[model samples]
Target: MSSSTLFSPLTFGDFKIPHRVVMAPMTRSRSAQPGNVPTESMATYYAQRAGAAFIVSEATQITPQGQGYSFTPGIYSAEQVAGWRGVTDAVHAAGGRMVLQLWHVGRMSHPVFQQGQAPVAPSALAPNAQVWIVDEHGQGGMVDCPVPRALTVSEIRAIVNDYYTAAANALAAGFDGVEIHAANGYLIDSFLRSGSNLRTDAYGGSIEKRLRFLDEVTDAVVDAVGAARVGVRLSPHITQRGMHCPDMIVTTLKAARRLSDKGIAYLHFAEADWDDAPPVPESFRRDVRRAFGGAIGVAGGYTEARAQAVIRAGWADWVAFGRPFIANPDLPARLRNHLPLTVPDTHTLFGGDERGYTDYPNAG
Candidate 1:
């Protein structure tokens, strides 16, 4: 209870958060074989920080086609479900609540990762970054991203089924809820942003049309798993690779309004991340909170002081911790005791041993 306004309890989705510190869904890319199944080590990692009010699992691909990065976990297969079962069991045993983040990389994925199939997106445009392709030994090979094949109307409907499948998997795996990864230059983001989506189809024209794909995906997840258990993450300003949501205020407000109709659980708005990324004004959060009467969680490089400032001002219901949780596994205790944060080692961020994963100390 000794927080600078960061340790207060808040409602996130269907669960009551003991503290506002949320462990963000960072892609560690360490899933084991066959279908990106989470291993026992992954469960141990999450359970170690069960004191967190809530935990959002790493980006779990909804289907094989949804995978853009290698080793990223998935929740669609029976094996994957059993794997995540171990994760949820660990978290719950440690008295923590966790949600699954379903993702599809869209144009960000390489054909090399899709069993030699071409990557697909709203349009045939390729993102401006390189995708790490996996070799026979599962090593990363950074290569230029290939242009994605345009998703036909039929293909769009099929992707909707994938969301439902993943949602069911989430429930079967004992996850308290599910988060739709609609932001951060992924498939959903590509469809929502005007720059990437140039299709003349019903899903790509004006703002309303651009929102169709996302709306459908949300509806599917909600239908599969009740609306009260669903949340969406959106990065309005983070321009990943070549992706850009320049008119973030407009898109964010509209996206909030569109999602409002679904009566969904919550909205996690990712303002910006990069050092040069534009700072999202508090007005945007106010706008989203106004448009979507449901809960709103805000993230992106916010320190303890800044996080408390926004929450104290009633701008957000929750603040997700990314880097802090990575280095300081005992983050909640650190915050409660006013302990200094440990610096995260960038080298072991993605695919590495447990040194940086769970070895950080909270206090002397």
Candidate 2:
């Protein structure tokens, strides 16, 4: 497949980039301890990968209650906001556009990260997922997720406000835009899928009810920042952590239409990347395009050639590369020149120092 489409310049919202390669947000869990703050070293990490058309920062919690994993950054505090400013400044200084992903882990969280209280979700069911947590000794390990408490209608409204505040903080931190983390069995995804959201209130039961949280969150975000600067990420086909619903495809198409009606800037699909993950059907892609006449981004285990083919075929407007960018800071250049790529060290992927974080060299 030709790489012309992948290497060509593209415009997303008010930001124009040299190419169509987006750097997907991968949680490295390297934030500073005590405050879950981004650091200068994190800035260096993003600055080195300025070659990406746009960089989506790893999921940053909107509030302490939204946190699930250890060492992830947050956007709800002044010090944390200042910490993220360093990252955004570095990316901009390197001539790159970047966005922050606002997240709430919901039922995926452990009580340890939630002030010894149960995590909040649309229902009290456990997703049977595990979250990374650090002990007072500074050692980190995975623990089973506890059954969460379902949020009240009032509580749901408060979280929406938290997302709005997070969007404002992202702008204050100097990001070009913000991507709402509504996918991957997180808070919003929990609401959207039936397996997790069993509430009978206005927020659950039927598909429309299940979609209420997403609609409210999107509306609050689009109102905070203009529609052009707001993006939403979804995983219609991913079955991770009991997120699969029989009507996932249909529900996602409806969600796409709703998001499109709101005039969102883009819709990102976090495709399943497991070796045996289900393939995104071509028919579903066509339906998504018809339903949402906006830029579409797909991320999974896409190679340069595969990404180009999808873009050329109009299945996606752009492609986001995740783990590849971890080991190849200048990934766009390497892909452009057909240079050999390096494999990322899995050991240092999460909660690590500079070993596999900023130590990767450009192709020589």
Candidate 3:
């Protein structure tokens, strides 16, 4: 298979990447506890994989109320910001450009992480989803999501402001830019789908209304950080619990136009990647290209051949590799030379210090 297109240079917003292989954000749960702050080990982990043209840091909560999983990093607190500073510094020192993903779990969160209060959402609905959490005993496991409280109009405005604050914090932490995590059945994704949002307010009912929340958040974030430095992640096909909607494709395409109007840097599509994952229609890809003027990045179970094909076809500008970058820190170099890759150990995928993290060796 021809992998030549993967090495082509591309300009994303203000950053010029030397190659088209990007690093997708993967949660490793290796952050320091007590405050859910990033650690120096996390810095080393990112620095080790600086071969990637661009790196999107793991989903970092915008505030305490935004956190859904334990040990994930945050950007709201001073300590958290300082912790992330080291991470960005390390990645930059290795000559890698990086962006921080701003996140809010919404109803995906459990009361255990919310100080005994129900998680907030666009509507008071249960996703029947589960999130990974660590108890006081330090045992981590998945627990079912509880029904969330409907957010009032005022509360929605506050959350939008929270996104703005987080974007500013990300810049201060030394990131080149920020990406709004509006995918994978998270807060913004849930708000954009009908199955999860059943409100009669201005932020619900019609497709335009369901998309209102995302628009507001995007506007706020772009306002805080210039649109040139802002990007957004969207999953048009994933039906991860409480996120399935009949018109997801149509809705997402319409939203793409809105994002394009804002002149944001890029649109990162989180495609389904599981063994039985459904395929994204080529029509959708073509339509997205027509709607957006900026670059497009795609992630999910992409092989070297498939990634090259997508870029060659002009359907995507860059490809993001999640698990492959975990075990092969020099993935771009390995792919450049057509070398074999090492599979990561599933057991040490999360909550570890550095065994499966920074210990991954470069190609011989």
Error of 2 at 337 (Å): 0.3
Local accuracy of candidate 3 as per-residue lDDT tens digits, 1-364: 2343999888868879999999999999988878998999999999998889899999999999998988889999999999999999999999999999999999999988889999999889999889998778878889999999999999999999999999999999999999999999899999999999999999999999999999999999999999999999999898878687999988989999999999999999999999888777888889999999899999999999989999988899999999999999999999999999999999888796789999989997
TM-score, predicted candidate 1 vs. hidden true structure: 0.95
Pick by lDDT: which candidate is best? 3
Q: Model 2, residue 212: what's the lDDT?
A: 90
Between candidates 1 and 2, which one is better according to TM-score? 2
lDDT of 3: 0.92
Indicate the residue-level lDDT of 63 in model 1: 89
Per-residue lDDT of candidate 1, residues 56-76 (tens digit):
999999988888877889888
Q: Residue 331 error for model 1, in Å?
A: 0.6
Model 3: CA > 4 A from native: 1-4
Off by over 4 Å in 2: 1-4
| lDDT (Cα, 0-100) at 103 in candidate 3 | 97
Give RMSD (Å) of candidate 2 vs. truth: 1.4
Write down the RMSD of all candidates, one decimal each. 2.3, 1.4, 1.5
Assess the local accuracy of residue 275 in candidate 2 as a C-alpha lDDT between 0 and 100: 88
Better of 1 and 3 by lDDT: 3
